[model samples]
Target: MSEKRPVFPEFDPDEVSSNPSDNRSFGDVVATRLSRRAALAGGTAAAAAFVMAGGSAQAAPRRGPAAGEEPAAAPAAESGRHGLLGFRQVETHDRDELVVPEGYRVQVLIPWGTPIQPDGPRWLKDASNSAADQEQQVGMHHDGMHYFPLGRGHRGGDRHGKGNERGLLVLNHEYIDQQILFPDGDEEMTGEKVDKALAAQGVSIVEVARGKDGQWRRVKSRYARKVHGNTPVTFSGPVTEKHPALQAGNRPMGTLNNCSMGVTPWGTYLACEENFNSYFGTEDPDWEPDTLQKRYGVDNVGFGYNWHTASERWDVAANPGEVNRFGWITEIDPKDPRQTPVKRTALGRFKREGCMVTEARGRFVGYSGDDQDGDYVYKFVGDRPWREHRRAGRSPLDHGRLHVARYNDDGSGDWLPLVHGEGELTTENGWKDQADVLIRTREAADAVGATRMDRPEWLAVNPKNKDVYVSLTNGSGWDSAATPRDPNPYGHIVRWREKGGDNTATSFHWDIFVLAGDPAYDEEVKLGDNLFGSPDGLWFDADGRLWIQTDVSNSSQNLPEKGYDNIGNNAMLAADPRTREIRRFLVGPRGAEITGVITTPDQRTMFVNVQHPGEATEAWGEPTPQNPRDVSNWPDFDPEGRPRSATLVITREDGGRIGA
Candidate 1:
């Protein structure tokens, strides 16, 4: 269908041959979002005008702040309402250290292998930590996270009071770096190696607070704990009837590849299971995946994890049903470890990314995306409101309707319900009931003609106007008019306003918020100074500042030929919703992707994660012990040190609001 292209074996593209072609692309809506004539002009005023219009030409004006919510935390002199950025913008660079604007400082906290408890095993620089030790230590590749104030009850934006000085930080460990994990450098597989790798993923809940010196430190509280691949998980929602595919002994063994996350109004943490299929493989050399398994990406040989070699738990040939128990949205209560982690099946599953929940008409409405190219975005609408559901001793998450999004060529979209008897989701299509529909959510969305997105990664809701935003992490197809480059390496973010400003509305209007790329490579650069690619994680602070995190693949971070050399390292930027004004706030170390971000209630202390530093062990050259030059060895500057993923706490020298 097109000209010859470079071969990338690891590239995950939209592979469904039967899927409808998506030509609406950035060319269609982006030009309309700015009026083709205005977009080609590339003038700052038109960009600001589009942003001030709340992303969509048909969208209503921005709504006022929610009740009891804090006031907008920032406003610099001469910036107008949202014009002036509070912090100096940091330039993109390839330094081996984390950098922030002047007058602000960064302190590395809780690096990987740090003991969860003070009495636990300390990290050994020689990579000799046992599998058991990993269970009690910080996990690898820190991602989406949140800060809950200590000594208080969290309820739907209520922190019980103004206690942000101390809190519990809950984060996700996406995956492991096998190259650095084993001292021998990816030697033959073993049960112990699999155990250690599995134990380093899932979620980490650790108590941390600022000391008298204003430095944050991890606290050894009773609440500090780790939930990993060995942790027992329970099921809830429409698919809790002990389906055969979900048979993993009496209970499911664990959650794998925990990526981005979300939080419920009642304060429970939602850990998204992304790339869960990589943990499964078949012992049978000639094994093949069934239709359902194929759609979910189950294969005979998994991206080299090789867990099946040592553990039947991951051997799909031995226990094929076990693979179905994963790919779910796991809920963990950080305050009480006694409560079991619940996989909310009502949300449906297909390599779940981030689940951002908002209160829609006293009930819960959750938004999530299936983080793969040509996948779909979904939302769950609860039937019962919060107060009534809680009084009746029910979880709002356990009773809801999940629907996939369908975008039109115009600037509008629809949420088509995935019910058992609805449309093609009937018994004739292999969907016996709602359980089957959710187990194979992707195909159901496909059956209903859902719009295939680039690589929907994360979703965030605005605090000021309740609008929604999603970061599409590039694609192998779908050419964009905003950029002239081929292959569209850098993705863009989209914003939408529900019909009549109601989050529960089944229809909405959308527009392209921004397209990210470096013009030097013949691709158009939309957001200057805040230039970035591969937008992965997103969050909106109390003051309505949209925080964006980049996830440039480690393989291309330093390669100029891949079109990312101009956008060095990864970075975190802050954007004002009212204007297209965006400023880079932080830049991570070489080879690392800046991910997972949050700040205190007062917006004073901010936490950002530096993940996978010193990645891609040399592609332009070969490596040897005498000249083994890794991309970077951050935090630990010793020549013999290993790069470790960690969280950093940033605060102003004057203790003022963050992004100020």
Candidate 2:
């Protein structure tokens, strides 16, 4: 066990920086280099397209087939390529194991508690499930997801493979771990352990299927559902119904701290809402909390989900309008479970993590980030062409516009425009219209002068070129020539293009794509054995590769005195964005965190997700069954098991295509 304390909480997002006057805000100064094995020992092909992506060394740009597009050599990478990351990488190993690569073939699928309702009830070890049986099982940790096939075609469904043989995965249960969901693991606060930890925080879907022996199972359909955190959501654009600083109530509920996710070309399922100011609290010793709940970190012991000292609707001073209906962006419709799950709120709210979506200029944008640290970076767009506001039923994320992102150090940027009465929002700066600026979307993105990044987690796009990438994940003093890092402690990845490739271009141009640490504390990460660091989940694969994932928490993974123990656990790489190459394709287990990845539409069944594997075992405060998990019991090693997070599925034992 790596004896490092701080095992997450204090409403983590590696947090701290509610903008203490210019939390440094990218003034510029990042030009380091020489690692990735000293830039691959000076090899050629433009030094193998160099770009270790940190403070720009540049060289790696080839990109082909666009104007009149036609480059179809699909047995995997050929169109403009350095073999577009074709497998065989997997290295760093602290193995409590789910390693992958070597003809990959994983398969765990749906873990936390399983049972997608068929009168629920499966999973039960010593950890006795139940907050209504963890809301019909399955919900705990797994983050950012998407699959959806079930009788296909809404845009790349069945991906040319039998409507993906029945689908509907969905995912995102980003919370709950009261030491493996209670059984007196860390007992005491009740309301039935805060209703089984807000019934294991929101979003699930389930309905999988592939079984004709190709393996994928779990289909007790009625299109399986979950959505809880106090479910009963509803609300949409322009802050839903006249915002007077949003005093909303009348049964407004939502998608909870469900992290990393997005998907909707009308297929639905976005579920963002990171750290919802940790499930609120206040046993009122004179309850305080203003300055937008301390600029949205809200404390009084949350993150340890004391759900308001055992639930009074998570007492923010007795339901302060139930924490203004939770940090927005819900939108589920996993093939209709009677719809209901909207939120949207013009996609502004802070704590939102991933959103992605493309198709610019003719509208339908969407790009989101707001994951804290010096927060900001958003998009939105759509005032049309989301099938023209879903054929008049409205809600292309409530008739678009949002914006906010500034960057500039010469690499140019500016999307700015959180709009209210324009510039610095009006009504003497506290705007009163656009529903109080979409209910204080970070004080209307701190009234205009945006660019405060370094926490912008999950965002990816590349419908063959309008680019976009993201995953700032950590931060320090901020230098901003695209994440120049200060004390960043590994964590990078940024990319952009959008201007002429206009994803509704409000102007753009960026760099630094992949610098997630360790070339001996990163001289722009020189990938020796493909060492990795905090780049938290991204995705691209339709063969443009990208992929990446890693969270490194649990007091910074194996801690080599904090240089991140040779970067082992928490992995999942595969870059090659025009050959800046990156490799290691899967490594998660001890203390797991390689999260939500997707595939299948003939991308041959990938899936991923691991999450909270051993809950950072220092004997996880009494995780019994003869002290279950000192590191991991992953995908069930059942000695009365107790480490689960699960949903791997992998496959490629010749079925080909995953990461091809």
Candidate 3:
């Protein structure tokens, strides 16, 4: 990929808050990941290393927690009465007023609409946010986030071990829901609303300090910054220069719908652009559907957002070509706010939902999901070996070939390359060439028989086993069958092992790790003993404990007897993958989907987001008890109240590791 095609928010240090270094060690870890910049320059070295290590079939099977490496077990109260199935919620009466269990407390460090820049407009109810100013505000709908402690000044190591005082916090500001964002409607948003909403859609780079009082607060720091939608981002790797997607404007601008995020082994943050397709409008009405577009996703919608009617006419003003700029994995260096983020197009673009980086045979492997009906799962293999450049302070992310997965009838698969000039992709029945194929990757994946999946959302690699975990929602014809069977309808957590025992291999084996259902009675629908419903947000603790979160939208109406009938909303589950045992750990307030889980290094503090609590607008009210004046006041202070989307932090009643 080439860096010439810039398409992200520009770098602006003046827009950041100036705070002193409190967590230096944590920053060092992040800096180390960003510094190792050249190992990814060559692809053959990484490919060979995987082959030399012997393929997947012969490698040592992953092991679970060893005898003494585990933290002391959490007490019964924290673990819940149902043994492994219990989650104690935290209590708080902040802006987001949702309920948590006893003995827990949640702090709203940065709520939705919180300003990121110093002089940014305060998020008001009337919608005064603008695009020019959006560059200085916090992005909306915060989703997947990770808290990394800064390393000791420049000493390169785990800051948590050295009792470091300061650290850099990288959080993702996901999609901006137009309904609640703009005062009237998306079409009603004016200058300010548009700007504010755009600014709130990217990532926030801030500094945090653990006060002597034992609480974490946003440090009054210089590093507090917001990377808005219009930031200048460089394009790099694989499909960068040749694709029509990149051809949109010589350079694309802004990243929209950033959802599930990934932290590289090297340290920089990977912010994925999900649901970006909804932002673009087709200028070429005669735009014949490419075979690749038809296969991957792009064929359905014609006219997109009529930005002229809303705030900041990104569609009409800035660059109408701007829509194509989105939908790539953007890499950001949190340590140095001055660095420009890069859109790694080699990863393939389409409603990209998540990025999970893992290592096999000393190579870097990345797994991403396209969050659309019947989309395909894709992975990238770096060209060079993933050496301990981080130990030496460097970033190894430049070279890699993008490939899509195909689940064969025999239950095996191949990682078909989407590169423009080479592989089986070049000699196909359709595409002009490899570059043509990369531009329409979804279509190309279909050309190769890649298994279509239900809207694939978040993805997390199992820490202990090194298996890739993917969340598959409803399936569209392009990715899977419309009915519930092998891979559609009732989505499951799909896991796969790289074929060459290396992260960069072109083949792998896969299976449904866990299926979602109501285990209490729906045996036919539930694949596992601990049956649940629609699995969405997913994360793995340092100990490799797989935390599965749910996103059941319609509530009681969707699941009548699945135990979700008029009760607790979407819940979070902690499962031991090795044993295939899953237990509901925590549930959110009414009408909210549980998302974005991140833990401190010690695993003591867990942060989760409750998105759109009072989603059912009709459920909200005028003078009735059901209809609260403002849905913003949630996690309800009054037990019998409306719901709101807020961030919830959870920890043990005994100050121990969360899932220990």
Candidate 4:
């Protein structure tokens, strides 16, 4: 049978178009492509060699004894040397269960439909839970997440606490599967069906505790809360005044398509609203769509959620302004469950993958990706420096300066401010004010000539060096007659050092850290045993080891026709930035995306989320106890069992630090 492809969110025109001339309209030659495919296909060997050597340093010379001399013995793990040296790389697998390194063990922590509230309805085997039950229980399709310790004050626990035993796990539920979410498949749109779907898409904050034996489990606590798509939210920033639809007294209810996330210095969570334009319909006559809406692909035929059938708020034609409420970074306070999530407007509206916050020169700075091919990278600088005592009051994200990135062919880049009065972003260019510049960020970026990237997914800041790393996922359609850009069929990771080694700097130097692809496809750049593609879900541990996760499509996994076929399945990898050595750490189940990774402050226990397992399966015929048609029944590989997305806790068998 043919593999069923998953329907992802809509892509911007620039992301899918083949005309390279379209990129020329922005007034600059596209930055040189650093992808391995472009390198092998016919770029200069010197350039390819530079990329293989990690772009920053040349390959180290062999330090061992000569052929006639004896080689020295390797050092022990307990020695002063730190980081991922003790753990062996795990081979890629295409099984239906989570796979980890030999010494590491994985346990299923929290699965979707698990009840968070004491009185919430329990998960039924047949998947017959009600909309109210879903709202009270854990939502579906877990994505990005963070762990906040319970008794360590608002600052969280120390990195070497006694196991860092307890904390609140805040995770995002990206989307839902109608066939699996509803007991009876959703063949028709009903208020009940729509409600259940809505209840399954926002964020979940659950309290989890680790026992004396090192096992972790979710427990009922006052802090447990569910912020779904129907919850009420307030809009902040310049958008409220710039868009009449978001004016006073027009509070938007809930957030949809929450993809990736970030934690603020004040300890709040920032859940990104990605692909939100697909949730609303454009049939209302009163709604007049603008160029921005058209560019985002907002149209009459919705993503099939059909929320408009039961609620007018989902009808953009009737309430055109409502669309403006989404696409902004949402701030949620997990400690205070009753607090309403706030839409932070200062970050600028876009299909954000998420934002990563770090302190630089006493100020708070955030980096985020638009998550579409040909889109620009952005950064927001808070107006004031972060104060330890200010955690009780206002959010630092309320006021900030947003900037887009412009990369030079020589490995230098600058952050062009999105301020209205700035160059190219003036009245003559159709930017009326700061709000207008932010509301139409893509257009403003085009005007300023920001560099176009291939589906920037996640941003991570190295704890040791403060350098920033971004995952540029795979893309195609670069071969055009007018102009030709690199067709990065496989993904790669890009790292940049901020000018003067400061996170707030507007200028920086960058290099291709690692070109991801099958080793067989690229001989010169291949880092044996570490070859992987479509880099996504990046984070750095306290020890500064970068963890990279893969998100290969179902049709591409194990297919000989694809470049990544040799890399069994979507997996996670660890890399030491100093040496540029990337090693595979774990491989996730088939047809699932490995995402949402976080470890305890003690660095002993780690949590990783597996999203949408069995996504490639066809849901047809009547449901029965004998057989539940599934392409992959992960977590519980029972033939008749229904596949559910879940979280896995990984620990070392020797009771030592993870990845040691």
Considering every candidate listed, which one attains the maximal lDDT?
A: 1
Model 4 CA deviation exceeding 4 Å by range: 1-83, 152-163, 241-243, 247-251, 282-289, 388-393, 477-485, 522-525, 617-629, 638-640
lDDT of 3 by residue, 396-447 (tens): 5556677876654333457777766554466555567644565566666655
In candidate 1, the residue pairs with backbone N, CA or C atoms under 3 Å apart (3 or more residues apart, or in different chains) clash, namely: 79-84
lDDT of each residue in 151-172, candidate 4, tens digit only: 7533444554543888899999
Q: Which candidate, 2 or 4, would have the higher lDDT against the true structure?
A: 4
TM-score of each: 0.89, 0.35, 0.75, 0.86
Which candidate number would show the highest TM-score if scored against the true structure? 1
Error of 3 at 205 (Å): 1.7
Runs in model 3 lying further than 4 Å from the true structure: 1-103, 117-135, 153-165, 187-191, 238-251, 282-305, 308-320, 387-396, 421-424, 427-433, 476-490, 519-521, 525-531, 555-568, 617-632, 635-645
lDDT of 3 at 293: 34
Candidate order by TM-score, highest to lowest? Answer: 1, 4, 3, 2
Q: Whose lDDT is higher: candidate 3's or candidate 4's?
A: 4
At residue 250, give the lDDT of candidate 3: 34
